[model samples]
Target: MAGTQSYVDDLSGTLDERLIISSTPQRSNALSNKFSGVLSASYADSEIRDALHSLDENEIKNTAETRRRLRLNVQKQVIQRNGAVVQEYGHVAEQLKRIGAIINSLTACCEVMRQHVTAARHENAPVLEEASSLLVQKQELETKKQLLDAFNKHFIMSEEDLLVLTGATEAVDDTFFGVLMRVKQIYVDCQVLLGTENQRLGLELMDQSSRNLNIGYQKLYRWIQKEFKTLNLESPQISSIIRRALRALAERPTLFQSCLDLFAETREHILTDAFYSALTGSSSGDNQNPVTKAIEFYAHEPLRYVGDMLAWTHSAAVSEREALESLFISDGDEISKGFKAGRQAEPWSAGDDEAFDGRKALGELVNRNLAGVARALRQRIEQVLQNHEDAVLLYKIANLVIFYRVTFIKLLGPDSSMLETLSSLVQSALRQFQTVVSDNASAIQAEIAAPTPDLRIPAFLDEALAQFTTLLKTYDSSLTAASSSVADFKSIISQALNPFLATCEKMAKETNEPSAGIFMTNCLIAAKTTLSAYDFVQDRVSELNEQLASLTSSLVEYQHAFFLHTSGLHPLLAALAPTEDTPGSLLNISTLPPFQLQPLTDAGQTLDDFLPSALMDAMENLKRLGNTKLSQEITADAAERFCEDFEFVEGKLTAADELREIALREGGEENEKEEQELVPLRSLFPRTSGEIRVLLS
Candidate 1:
């Protein structure tokens, strides 16, 4: 039992050793090579030693059996594992063969495919080339299609577009306008097409567009005419669409002018009807507005009648002009664009491409609209002026006409028929005014040529001047300050005012000396005062001033003469008169008999009596002077002249007294008698130049 146990143990150890040797190949190989003949080497030295120690001799002898059995077990394990490996290698070899067969078949198939492709290429060369050409053609066709589509969209207008543009039944709306713009664009773009190689298309399209554009403009022209016929000019807000339509129509000048003519005719009739309504109080048997009195009601008042007629005409003209302006000028930019397009289409429209002048056209239309009323206005005013006898009223009518003429000059240009008619009417009224003035002057010259006995302005002259003043007030208030040139205003003053002043002067000439001067002075003073308020009348006023100065000088001279004569100084003056042979030398009146001491003594007594009441007497003499200030001024001036004459008399007396003294000294008592009578120069005159100057001052 012990031996069997040891043998089992030994077998277990040997199996462990074999597993270790198999795990360590280098050690196992070295051990096998070095210890091949030794039993101890068959097993590991450690394994033999362990066996010897653990086993008895019987058990050790059984080690050989253990070894044999172990060998058998290892060989069987090797056989089993080798069988598995060989079976795996055989399966791999079968797979490699299958793979080789597949490669050969694939190579053969590839060669066959290559040969077939080569043959196909040789057989269908023309077809391949044809296919390539077809592809290029297809691409070109696609590009052409795209270009044709773009060209059709851009440069061509469809028939529907033309229908919208030129159809009379079509409403003038935004779509119609937009289509018109496109058509116009197409028309203008035809020029570009004309510059290309294909001018036929351009020419054809241009002709077609030209006809269509003409038709459209004609339709628009008729449309504008219809709108204008029913246009309410009094409305403040005009349609923007109508304004745009007119701007579009301006491209055709002839058509535009025709439309304007129609509009003008319509407006003329309307304004004429309105004016007639204002004048007669009714147009169609309807009473006029109560607020606006009919001009005919004031016919008895010619000035107010004519004024009302002109006022109504002017108001109507202004309203018409403003309506036309609103219609034309609101779309000025669009109008300019259309005008430029038309000029471009027809370069010969004018040599210059100036823009449409709205201002000038508006003036023409306004003038035309006022034409119907202008004749009536002129005839009515002229008839009133002719029948009126009051120069002032006729002058007022002329001024009213002039005021309207100036207003129409701005509203309807200077060359307008309305202005021309007003001008002729003004001439007619003025002619009538002048005729009345001349006739009045003729009658006044015959009847009231003599001034009043009190040296005042004649009643006829006063009435004429009052009428003249009325004319002046009318003139000054009726026109603007800048309206008339100095020459023209002077002409007006000459016609209306100068005749009365001239008649006054003529009447003044028929009166006596101081009275004539006073009357003329009164007339001139009144004229200057009435006219001085106006700046344009200054020239005539200056002339009047010159005449007044002349008349004042004459009156002063006459008064001075009267003062010298009344003061008993004339004898002294005759004594002191400058000698003709001596040119400037005074007469030696001391030696003259009149300047002798007795005569000088008598002159002194007379001078003493006149000096006491000199200024009062002068005032009484010229008391008929109308202006009191002028009377005082003239009286003082004459008193001073009287003082001058008295001084001369005193000087002659002193000279005579000196002569007397010389005679008395030379021939003792020969002139003593005369010297005693002279009583010295101061005592005889007793009035010194200083005392006389004091009295005058």
Candidate 2:
């Protein structure tokens, strides 16, 4: 206890001295103030200690025990403070372990991150190389684009220049080949530059090129038209130029077609216009007949020109056909092979050959043109026949129609309608001729029937007959040339002449005078002579001769009747006939006195005057019948018999008294009582009795 007190006192003294030494006065004062109370208490404890020391030993033991107890409490507090420090140390150790684990985990994560980054870099290496290559390619494409842009500009410029040079523009030039070459080059270049990758652009460029080519071709066509217009079609130079132009365009189908169309149009215009003018006679400065000129022009120049053009067209078609065949073969089509085999198998017929040969197209053109010309000529001829009364012209026109029909048939084949038109024209002309003949026959008939019949009737009749014969002759030739039957021509002529002859007969009947008979007979004889001259009309003339013979027989009969009436023999004959009262008895000339016969001088004179000049002429005609050979032999014999009868009548007149005495003797009673009946002529006059006795004796 004493030691603890001493330690405590020493600790306090050390603390007081340290305070005095380290502390400022203010600090010492604050410390002194703070300890003041402690010091006072200590002083009191010292006083108490002194008093305890002085009082009793028991108080000293108690102070020691209190020190011991305070020491124990201090020990206990120190132990508690050490225990808290130990716990803090353990917590700090756990914290260090946890921080070490977190660091290890962070290190592992960093390592994994590094490995992934390395793999990514490895995978991206080829991509970066590809990107670098792409950059190079982009640069190249940009350069190429710039080049293509320049090429496009140059190509467009070239196309424009080609258009200008080819006269697609307003500038006209003769550099067609050069322009075509340049345009072709530009087109090929554009195709190359556009490439297959830019197929759409390439197609557009090709279309533009094709349009430009078409424009160039059109310009060439216009140039050809202008040049051709300046040249005469008939000139040799024109043909040469045409050939050259055709050759130039031959390779170009579209341009060639354009030229061909132009040619066709021009040809049609020229031919149609010329034909119309010729047909209408509106053409200028020509002396020849329009029909002739039309025929000549159509038959020659237009035909030749059309033929040439058709030949060219046919050649072009052949070339096109060949090209198509090749294309079809390349395409593996069976049609071309089959068509070729068929063509080889069946050779064309002559007409088919001609049609298929280069001439078919030309034939069509010529046929159409000629048909038009034929129609025009036919119309003109019809007009002429209608307006003009010229028989000669009608005959000529008829012949022309026949000729044209034949020509058209030969040139245009039988299918052509022009043949029908020609046939119609021929018929019309024939009808006109028939009308003319009828009218002329009527006029002649009227003249013959006039009161004082024209002496020129025979002349007119001769002229008409001659004209008819001429027409018949012309028709015969024309009919033969036209492949018409002779029967047809004969029928036509008969139809025309029969009516005219009948009119003449009618006129003869109306007049009924001997002169009219003589006039008609003469006209008929002239007609018969004229008609008989032509072999075609021989039968008609023979028929007319028979009619004349019959008319002559009637005239002779009238003459016989007139002879009997004029001679006064009729009354004598009537008186001599058997009477009804006599029955079988003859005339009793014996009982009757001798009858005195009158001289009848006036009757003879009347008969003589009644014999007209026409009768004399008829007798003269009959007498001339002897010269007509076998055809008139019967009429000649009849005339001779009539003359003999006239002579017999004269002799009978002188023997009239003798003939009466003989008749009276024959009728006596002795002859009447005879058993055998006497014949009338035998009883009146004997067979030996002269012809004079039968009449005037």
Candidate 3:
């Protein structure tokens, strides 16, 4: 596999907080369902402890060589530090030796005490002898020790040059509490030996220098986080530790991100509490608990309050505040998204037509997969009703409209009784429609009209319905909505009127200039007959559709019963039974066995095989019943053949008759002369045969 890498960068942008940029993802190890580390354990968490642990044993192991090296480095860092300490301490020891040597011969026991005193001075440590040991030695040197008020105090800013080289920093203390006050002598010695400073000042400078390493910790952590992503691991702790360090150091971007993350928890807590309380009839003010208060402060407080406190940890108010936030915030859950979708109404309908526009919101709702709404933002406001295939949106609309009507009417006061009546009637009317609208017209209308009239609805109902519509545009639309059914009636009337129009146009085109000779009375009768025929054909199509619908219902019931009866069918085939019979026939539908259609794509079942059983049965039965008609259709073809043959025979007869006349004429005078030889000119003029001869010799 190709190795992967990433760089996460935080850069200041239009927003105040620096934005972290994640490098484009590269192919990685498959995503693992590893549980994320939430840092429930202490000791600065998995990543921090892990990183600290990861330093090589040799790195952590402070051997004598390490200490020697660090001592050398410290010596190099402070000018004349080791030399000054060594020289200064040596002078004090020599002076103490001279004083002790002078008193040494005073007594044998005194000489031994002098030797012990000299040895203690030579070692650079403070000569803190236990009281018992001092007493034993003091008795021995009672006279000759010259009443040493305090053991000569000598300090050494001594440098052990090879300490760092021997890994002195990594040496584990053999006892507890070794890391704090019991620090390396080299660090202490370097502090004393360099420049002018007391012990307290030296400690302060050390503390100041150590904080710079924390910045490194933060940088290194982030670097590791990016690498983890490139490597395609589960939620790793490395990035979080990096963030934690930044937060600890009050890095602005990390601090804000930490707050933002905590905000989610706080928001959820508050919302959950509120939602629960809404059901429980508790007030929003019930957030008196420390946790609840923190959550509320985080969620609802002005941004400035959080900003100041987050800058530092000593800000007790913020610490308490953050602690409280971590306790109980919850992001709100979406119970319902009041999306409005309406039915496709007739073009002429005066009420409302189904339409939706999401050009802006389209980017949102389509992405959401109808899983209600996203928790991050309000579901969003769509200007038009949403149109989806779900029939529930329609029923939901009717229910909603009922709510609006009653609510608005009650808001209008005692006179609003009419609103209640209308609301109920409207709901009842909706239940009776043959075409079930699968959209949200009622939601759209109610959202638009609810606020305009302040009628008395049930207070609970009023609040709820109001809350539901809170996101709708505040401005009322200028368009006037008509409530009457005339528009719908007009659509019906058009359906009634089209056939007459088609007839008129066809007739107008066909009219030859009938000579004004045709009587007006007869023309009127024909006109009336044509109009009647057009009207009849229009009604016939409607009747046919109604009959098909009726048949569809029966077929549905039959198919349902059939599948129920064939319960013993293979489990796969049982699911293939007829369902949702539409008015049109699918008797010729072709399909593979439903079993073969697994993992479906755009391919639809062919019309021949996928026919619903009811439709197939209905088709076969219809064919069996129409056998007589089928027979008639067969003879109809024969009738066309007979007509063609008859026309041919008639043409031959006419040709034969003409040929006889032409042949006799062509025989010339021979055939005619035998009969006409005895005929006089006037006798030849007899024209009963429809022939006349005219000749001049």
Candidate 4:
């Protein structure tokens, strides 16, 4: 077996050599065939084995040497590659060092350049700024020069043009009077042009024009003073001429009238366009009434016309005062003559009549102007109140009235008849406000009365009270102005609430229901609470509180009495304790034995009939009254007392039953004795024989 195995191993080795040689292209085909032939040679088994052993030892030795040589070669190649890498890294390090030096040099140069640039900027900044400033100044000077030239070309006028424009002969005339006349004419022309321009231009532009004209007016005024001094004019003549000049220049009657007309038209437009349209929520094309328009105008813009009107009225008043003082001083005889002639019903002289007529004309002017305004304002107020029921609007109207009152007083002087007219209007409005308050109070009272005896608080009560509080606050100023008005308001409220209190009191007295009194108490408490919510009721708060307390106390008493009456104790107690003049009394028991038993039996019987029903009703009533512990205790006590009395009366009847039973058992022998024994019992019980028999059975 060893020999066969050896041979198989030799064959396998030969085949393996052939496969390896076949895979190698570099091996010669002759060498591969020679190895195959050697393997396949016919040789003894031992010889082949020996050859195989030698070949194995040689192959192992060659494989070990080849592996050692390959390891040496790999180590040499690794060392060479590591040396090359180290050399390349040194070169890269050297290049980086040089590049870093270059970067540092560039940084230093940039720093020096930045420092120089900063120095240059600092050195040039002021010169650049100065040059810019000079250029701006030069531009400004050029602009001003252009504006001056334009102004000169446009506004500077020659003497002839000035004369033509101002209706003056010459601005610098030879004579002082002529110069004064020229200046006056110039002032007059400026005033006329200003008025014309004011009407055509807007308010801002007109303001500018007025400023320019004011300078001219000042010059004219100064020139007049100079001319008056030069001419050596008297004070009276200077005053007269100056007054004429000022009147002619400043008080342009036609222009003033035109301004008034414009004011009226503007007021009308505002009323129609803005105020009435917003107030009534309707377009006021043409159908709106003059009264409504006037009201809305005042309501919306109460101060719109006040300033202008006051100015005009003040000017007119000053003029009137001057004229009147002059007339009184200069024409006193003429006025006296006119008055005398009028008293005699004869025509006055021309001077007297003319003076009287002038006074009349001025008076008419003031009166008619103020009357129209006052009448229109009063009608507007009426229309406002009629159209709207706002208490706040009433206050607004009152405020407007006060403003007008003060304004008109100032305008017409407090003693003018116009003040009386305004006072009447204010009074009328106050009366209307009072009426509204009274009406509202009446309405609230009616609401309070409408609920049944149950007095369920009306749902509208809260809303009504809220409205009342608002109304009071709105008119608090007016109401507090006079104690009388406050009193009147209090009276109205009392009148309104009185009926409610009276009704409650009447119901409380008439009804046996405790709920009636409770309802009344609640109503009074509610009324008090509602009234207390209002601050304007401060004056009446104490009085109202007292009234509420009294009413509540009375209602409480009624409630307690009704509670007692429901239990039937009130009537029973009244009967038991009769007064001196009353005959029937339970205390009279000893004087009449017969009547004593009758009273007890009658009282017991009445209680039996009513106690149960009263107890049930009382239970229900107390339950309705909130089921308080006191009510429960009262009911229990009443029931216990009634039951005890019933049981006592039953026991007395039972004793009488036993007595009759004994008498019947003894027959005629014990009858007389039993009768004598029963005498007192009979008086106490008052029972008949049949009743006794029935009771005994």
Best by lDDT: 1
Better of 2 and 3 by TM-score: 2
Per-residue error (Å), model 1, residue 386 = 2.0
- The candidate 1 region of ten consecutive residues with least summed lDDT is 579-588
Candidate 2 residue lDDT tens string, 547-657: 877766665565554445554434433444432333222334322222122223443444345433323433544442323342244334443444455554343433543
Summarize candidate 3's per-residue lDDT along 130-161 as a digit string, tens digits. Answer: 66678878787885454333211112111331
Indicate the worst ten consecutive residues by lDDT in candidate 2: 349-358
lDDT for model 1 comes to: 0.76
User: Counting only residues 3 or more apart in sequence or on different chains, how many pairs clash (N, Cα, C under 3 Å) in candidate 1?
Assistant: 0
| Segments in model 3 whose C-alpha atoms lie over 4 Å from true places | 1-255, 273-657, 663-697
Give per-model TM-scores: 0.75, 0.43, 0.17, 0.35
The residue pairs found clashing in candidate 1 are: none
Best prediction by TM-score: 1
Error of 1 at 602 (Å): 4.0
Cα error, candidate 1, residue 580 (Å) = 14
Name the weakest run of 10 consecutive residues (lDDT summed) in model 3: 1-10
Task: Estimate every model's Cα lDDT from 0 to 1.
Answer: 0.76, 0.53, 0.31, 0.49
Name the lDDT value of residue 540 in candidate 3.
Answer: 38
